[model samples]
Target: MDSGGTDIIWNQFILGAALTRAARRVLERDGEEGEEIRFSYADTHAGGGGLPVPALLPVARKALASSAWAAAVGAGDVHPGSWVLAGRLIAALGGLAFEADVNDLDPAAITAAKASREGGWVRFWSHDWFLFLRNRLAMEPRPHFVFIDPPPDDPRGPGYAMDAAILLDTLGLPYMVTYAVDTPGAQPQEAIDQIGRSGLELRGAGLERGVLLGGGAETVVLDILSDLRNLAEVLGGELSVRLPRAPADDYCI
Candidate 1:
């Protein structure tokens, strides 16, 4: 999708494209330095299947070389659609199907996950995200990059646990976490201003409807590229992702 189009701001695929570009940039930098860097992916909130969004794995697969295949772990409602997509994408990328452990809390989602032939490569577990990761992370290789996309929630909304930043900060790993902050006026800017502190800094962000991420709704996406390396020169270059505001959709509220 071309950045020239105003519609791209609301298009979910832009996120995937941006991520793919970032992945390629990583490889290019590694190549330039005469060193190869490979990282795995761990995703929380894997979604209830049927992802129309562009596949991040495909782009990662397309770009990587030299120990290029990395493992992945995702936890979601299993939603059958979740495991199916993960398994296929891994296979398409020449990654071992066994490398992915996608779990869900619902028995039905688990059953759906297993029922799919893709289960052969996926470890679909009937476990909550917290419990699942506790055991999963201990087994062996831990994914280097974590992606968290929680459902839309107002910070003051009922049953709010914590923002993605706090959760990612607590994990103390490189992460890309996104949230939907439902507010009006300039409050979203205030939220972004408060995102970074001591050790963590914002690497990139997406905007929508003069807020963050997809228009018509208040969605904010903040990426903390890594704590493993200093991003000063890496991100300070001219290539910056700027998601301009789009016309609010009729469905936006």
Candidate 2:
């Protein structure tokens, strides 16, 4: 993911859209149960919120023109990062949602997140991604949705992948994993294989022009997948849903 001063690429837009849709789904599902369903969110690599990413204006203008959240961005000079976008969604639900645990390895990013919020819908954390996950493991009434957007050059990518599997197995909370893809179809497949090898099933997966996303088992992910596919059509990009391949040894014997 890009830093606060970097240009906001297309991937951020896709991510914001996915988070928006997923949070809305959580609201719909949990709204009926009253206090039984507490909406919680976490972003492992949340960047600074409400930074200007001029590259995204054209796309954002098109995709979010009808969205009320668009006004939050003002004149389109600034864009919301995944955490801010999710926070906006939670804010929309009034006071029903729990304050999200938004963390970033960058202290500057954490500061930016803190500066952008008008209310207490989000909490900030400055920790290594691995340590952050370990701490969140003990959180009661686990996060309803966790967003994992590791930096492109992050050395802990492999470790994060492994930990993600443990997170799903142990907590059973849904997650949305997004990464940059150099090739059209290469990265998404690799993500599926990695998740499969980790012994978790994909709830939904999609490859948009420059970004790939994989989800854990939840209906919200399904909705997110559908929204991405629709966005692909609007952008004249391709969206492919790949199934996780079973372990080779499982079928060999």
Least accurate 10 contiguous residues by lDDT in model 1: 210-219
lDDT against the true structure, each candidate = 0.35, 0.55
Best prediction by lDDT: 2
Query: What lDDT score goes with residue 219 in model 1?
Result: 20
Instruction: Give me the runs in candidate 2 sitting further than 4 Å from their true place.
Output: 1-38, 63-75, 182-230, 233-237, 246-253
Off by over 4 Å in 1: 1-15, 18-40, 51-98, 117-120, 131-139, 151-164, 167-174, 183-191, 194-253
Per-residue alpha-carbon lDDT of model 2 for 101-203, expressed as tens digits? 8888788888777887755467788887767866886778677677766665676654464456445634556665554443332344454554442121112
The candidate that achieves the highest TM-score relative to the unseen native structure: 2
Candidate 1 residue pairs that clash: 212-219
- Positional deviation of residue 78's Cα in model 2 after best superposition, in angstroms: 1.4
Whole-model lDDT, model 1? 0.35
Tens-place lDDT digits, model 1, residues 61-165 = 233212112222222322223334434433433323223466556676556445555433445555545455557656666543344443333333212212433
The residue-level lDDT of candidate 1 at 222 comes to 36
